[model samples]
Target: MILIALLALPALGALLAFLPGRTGRLAATCVAALTFGLSLRLYSTGPGFWYEFDRAWVPALKLRFHLGVDGISWPLIVLTTLLTLLCCLYSLWKTPDNRLIGLLLALQVGLLGVFVALDLVLFFVAFEVVLLPMYAIIAGWGGPKRRHAARKFVLYTLFGSMLLLIGVVLVVNQTGTADLAKPAGTATLAAFVFLALGFAVKAPLWPLHSWLPDAHSEAPTVGSVLLAGVLLKLGTYGLIRVAIPVAPTGAHKAAPVLAGLAVGAILIGGLICLAQTELKRLIAYSSVGHMGFVLLGIATMTATGLQAALIGNLAHGLITGLLFFLVGALKDRTHTGELAELGGLRESSPQLAGLLGFAALASLGLPGLAGFWGEAFAVIAAAQRGWWVAAALAAVGGAIAAAYLLRLLRKVTHGPSTLKLTGPAGYELAAWAPLVVGTVAVGLAPLLVTGVTGPAVDALVEAFTK
Candidate 1:
């Protein structure tokens, strides 16, 4: 029931967000804050699921309204709620637009649903629910090219959704159950391939990732934050939770192919980032490289590798979300994200420049920062898994990341003052402080995340190896 409340509160807020005008925004903010409090309470309970809900939803088809959380999903649940609160805070500082707040709350509901859902049918439905609100966010609130980007996003995701539905139907039909615990091994090769392909679209792996840069470039700040933050995790999470565990043999067979694509993304994305002149687009490209490391981690199929993947997911969320927020803040002042037109930010807005530097350092995987553990662990996991070539290539990715990020710093934060940008606003600090703290905290103590995800990873690895 508490789990239901955790999922329902934001949805209810989305409905209540229609209250008059400004009241709607206030209502949404309060609801998000309450949800954040609930998430913290959940975290305090510590490292496992507390609530259980299972009852028949579609009796004829053997579906159930099942929902729960485990250590595997706990961090993501908290992260989702926290990001929603921050988005709301940022919205409150801006004009309290009714539609924006409403959409945000609705999106929060969809994200929470993904983390808690235990039935395949329910997961698919929850997954589809997220698509519309995000489409609206990008299309309605985005930049001049938003419509095209939004359409591209919709088309790509919709196609993936179709494949996902096919995979789900196949799994349920074959196993006669929608429960995630049941082995989806009957038609393992076909089912796993379909599921992995579907998710890879959302994961935006290598060749399938063309839509991401456009979407990020066009989306508004909060849209990009949640998109890069939690939404991207959905696909990778599915691979971990559903695709691999259910079809271990198939996953093993596909590992080499996945590893190849992961390496491609890392190298290609890094190279593209080097040539990019637009700030948001470069950040968007960097995600490809970052997610590449995550993919490499998963492809390794070892306990250490899985742990690295989970940590990388969480780290990417924090680091990229911060980067988007900082870039958005600068864009708000300068009206452009073009690198050539922006320089000497430290001269006029030292605080913003400093934050940007911090974000860049974390993004480049600077040791003693949040980003370090994931990439470092990824390389270590690859080496331990005996893919020496992958280990070498991944190391190269790290060097490229450093190169591109340092270039960004020298071009935008140092040098002669080019644009007179204002420092960050109060709302910006309020939103940024948590991400900053998370970055440093995770950097200093990787165990905060590893501790929670370890048991789950061990169990999965045990199951897979069997």
Candidate 2:
């Protein structure tokens, strides 16, 4: 019931957001706040599903209207809610378009649904539900190349979706049940491959990642935030929850390949960031590198690796979300994101410069920050699996990450003043403060995330071992 309400509130708000003027915006913000409140009820101690709801939806096909929450999913569900709420609140001042607010809320419903869905078919439906609103968000309100970026984003994802649908169909036909809780009886390697490739495209793993930079560079601020913050999580989450479990034999066989590609993404993404000249595009490329670390953790398929992946997922959501927000604010003020055209941020806006620096440091996986644990543990997990070469390369990737981020700071915040920009707005601070606090909090006590995910990760690893 709580889970239903958690999803329903945003859904209802989305409709209400079509209302006229401030009424719609206020309604959306209130609804978002309420939805965030509802999500809090999902938290619980220990492992396995803390709550579950299942019902038959299609007798003929064995599909069901099933939703469940567990240690592994609770944090993500909460993150989806929190980020949506913050994005909505940020929209109130920055965007103020009722229609945009509506689309954001609509996107929220799909994100929450994905985190809570327990049936593969339902998960796929929730997954696909996100496409149009996001496409609309990017196409309607984005930069000069909006249409091109949106079309590419949709085309790339649609191709991935086709593969995902085939994988889902294959799994369902073989097991005769779409319920993820049930064993995937004799599911083939081909099914896992289809799913992995589909998800990798969304994770926007290197090579398949071309669509991401364009999308992020052209997307509106809120759109970019959601894209980097939680939208990307769907892919990594799908890997953890579906691909590996449903096809363990394939997972074991393909682990090495996944690790290799992940390292490639880490190194390649960082190298690209080092060469990037646009602020938003640079941050966008950084996501490819960061998500690469998360994927590396997943490839190891050990308890340590999975736990690292989970925390890394949450940390990226916090740190990268903040980066996009800050970048958006800077762009809004300077009217440009070009690196050479922007300099001495501290001279014009010390507060914003300080925030950007903090975000940059956190992004670089600085010790005692939210970003540190996941990358460190991912390398450790790879070494644990005796993939020493992959670990060493991933470590180099980390150093490369630090180099690029510091370079970003030097280019944007340390030189002679290029533009006189106003400080961040009150509403902006209101929206950003939580993410800032969350990053620091998680950095200081990773247990806030890890404690919840540990048991669930252990259970999944146990099942995989069997």
Candidate 3:
């Protein structure tokens, strides 16, 4: 029931926000705040428990209100709550519309529900629920090309979701239960292929990532923040939550091809990032590379591999979220995201320069930060599994990461500082600083997240090992 409450607040708020006179923002913000409080309550209440609620809503079909949370998902839920609260507070002063807050809240509801819903039908519904509000947010409030971006985003996502639905139905009919805890080898390989394609599109792995740069480049600051910070995780999270556990034999069988695709995303995304001229689009491409690393971790089909993938997912969320926020701030101030059009910013806004530096370093996996462990673990896991070639390729990917990020930093924050722009405004700092500090803190004390997640990981591994 608590899980359901947490999931419904934002949706309810969205519906209510259409009223007159500041009602939407006020109500939505309060609802977001309450949702965050509820998320925290789940943690202080118990670190390693799943608060569950279920009642048959459709006895004829065996579907129910089934919802739950565990250590594996709890941190993500907390992270979701914290980021949403930050997004809300950040938007207080300058967020565009009363309805915008409602949309933000709606995105949060969909996101939190994605992490918690246990039934396949329920999960897919929540997963697709995210699409509309997001599409509306981008097209309604984003850059000049908002319509183009939104159309591309929706069309691609719809196609993927349809394929995902097909995969889920095929699996459910064969396996007899949507509970991912149940093993999933009964489905034909065709179903697994559809499922993998559905997810890979969202992960935007390699060739399927074409829509991302447009969405990121065109989205509003808050939209970009949520898109990168939380939304991108949905596909990967689905794979982890549903694909792997539910179809272990299939997942294992598909590991090599998946790993190959991951490596391709890494090298290709890295090369493309090296060539990007728009700051937001560049960040989007880097996500392609970063997600590639996460997939590589998952492909190892080992305990360490799964752990690396999980950590990578969380760290990528934090780092990319911060980066998108900074990009938005820059865009707001300079009225541009084209790299060549802008010169150095360090002299102009020392604060902006410094924050970008920190975020870039973290994104590149600077040691002792949130980004380091996931990449490091991936390399180690790959090597340990005798995927020495893939490990070497990942190392090369890291080097490529360094090249693009360092070059980007040099272009934007170093060399000239000639933009003469003002420093990060109070509100922008308010939104960005926490991300920087949190990224660093998580980097230094990775165990804070890893510790909470370990037991759950052990349980997941038991399926394959035991």
Candidate 4:
């Protein structure tokens, strides 16, 4: 029932949002809040599947409506609900459109469903469920080039989806069952290749990442928040939950190439950010780099590497989510996101400047921050695999991250007041405060995440090794 409510509440809310007037908006917000509260009931102490619901869905195909939650997926589930709730809250003031709210709730259902799905067919259905709603959000409510950006997002992901569909069909044909709980049973390397390539596009790994910057730049504030915060996680999560486990030999064979491309994304993404003129574009590019680290961790195929990747996923979601929110606020106030035109933010809005600085520093993997552990451990995991060169270059990517993020701060926060701006509004603060508190809390005690993920990651590593 808890699992069902986690999806059903938002689904019902999405339907409610289509109704007229403030009543729809209020109901949606309340639904979001309730979903978050319901998500809390998912918590448990063990390193096993905490809650599961399974039923026959397609007898002919051997597909099931299977859902399960474990340490590995629980945090992401909570994060998805929390961010959706916050996005809904922000919409009350910023967007105020019933349709947009409906879209967000619909997106939440997809994201949560993706995390809990235990059958490959079920997972694919949830995975694809995320597409159109997000496309609509970006196209309907985004900036000047919303149409173009939305089109690109859909095209790229749809291409990935084609590959993913092929992979899913191949897996089911070979294994004779879609149950992820069972061994993949003689699935071939080609199946894994299709899956990896498909997920890579969504992960926007390096060469595949071009769609993201435009989408983020054009998406409205709440859209950007969810895009950075949780939508991207679907790819990385799919990699861990689906691709690697189902095709361990393929993953092992592909690790070197995967690691190489991930390093490229890290360095190349950082370099691009350094040259970016627009704030949102810079942040969007930064995701390519940040997710690079997570992919690197996964590529290592070590228990430590996998754990690092999980934490990296959560950290990026929190820190980058906050960055987008701040950037959106700046654009809303100054009527510009161009770095050159936006100066002396500190002079006009010291509080906002300070929060921006904090988010920037945290994003750059400052020691004692949430971002540090995953990056640091990823490097250590690479070294553990004796990939000294990869580790060294990845460290260089970290340095580049620091350089670009600090540059962003100097350009926006330190200059003499370019335009007078007010501090974040009450609702804006309400939306942002939890993220701020979460960043600090997670940074201070990574165990809040690591403790839960450790056993599950260890189990996953054991499976692939066998």
Residue 283 lDDT, candidate 3, scale 0-100:
98
- 1 or 4, greater by lDDT: 4
Model 1 TM: 0.98
Score every model by TM-score. Answer: 0.98, 0.99, 0.96, 0.99
Error of 1 at 11 (Å): 0.5
Candidate 2 residue-wise lDDT at 231: 92
Q: Quick one: best lDDT, which candidate?
A: 2
260-351: candidate 3 lDDT, tens digit per residue: 88888889999999999999999999999999999988888777877888888889988899898888888888898889877678888888
Candidate 1 lDDT tens digits, 1-466: 8888998899988988889988888888899999988877765334335566888898987788998877788888988998988988898777477788889989999999988898988998988899999999999999999999999999999999889888888887777667875555554767888998888888877878999999999999999999999998888888888888767888899998888888888999999999999999999999999989998999999988888889889999999999999999988889989999889988989999899999999999999998998888888988997889988998899999999999999989888996777778889899999999999999999999998888778877887787
The CA lDDT at 62 in model 2 is 71
Worst 10 residues of 1 by lDDT: 42-51
Angstrom error at residue 382, model 4 = 0.4
Model 4, stretches more than 4 Å misplaced? none
In the range 86-117, model 2's lDDT, one tens digit per residue, is 99999998889999999999999999888899
Query: What lDDT tens digits, residue by residue, belong to model 4 across residues 1-466?
Result: 7888888999999999978998999899999999999898899867668898999898876779999999889999989999999999999988899999999999999999999999998899999999999999999999999999999999999999999999999988877778776556467789888998889888888989999999999999999999999988888898899888888888888999989998999999999999999999999999999999999999999989998999999999999989999999999998889999988988999999999999999999998889999999999999999899989999999999999999999999886885878899999999999999989988999999989998888888888888
By summed lDDT, the worst window of 10 consecutive residues in model 4 runs over 177-186
**Residue pairs that clash (backbone atoms under 3 angstroms), model 1:** none
Candidate 1, position 364, lDDT = 96
Q: Model 1, residue 229: displacement in angstroms? A: 0.7
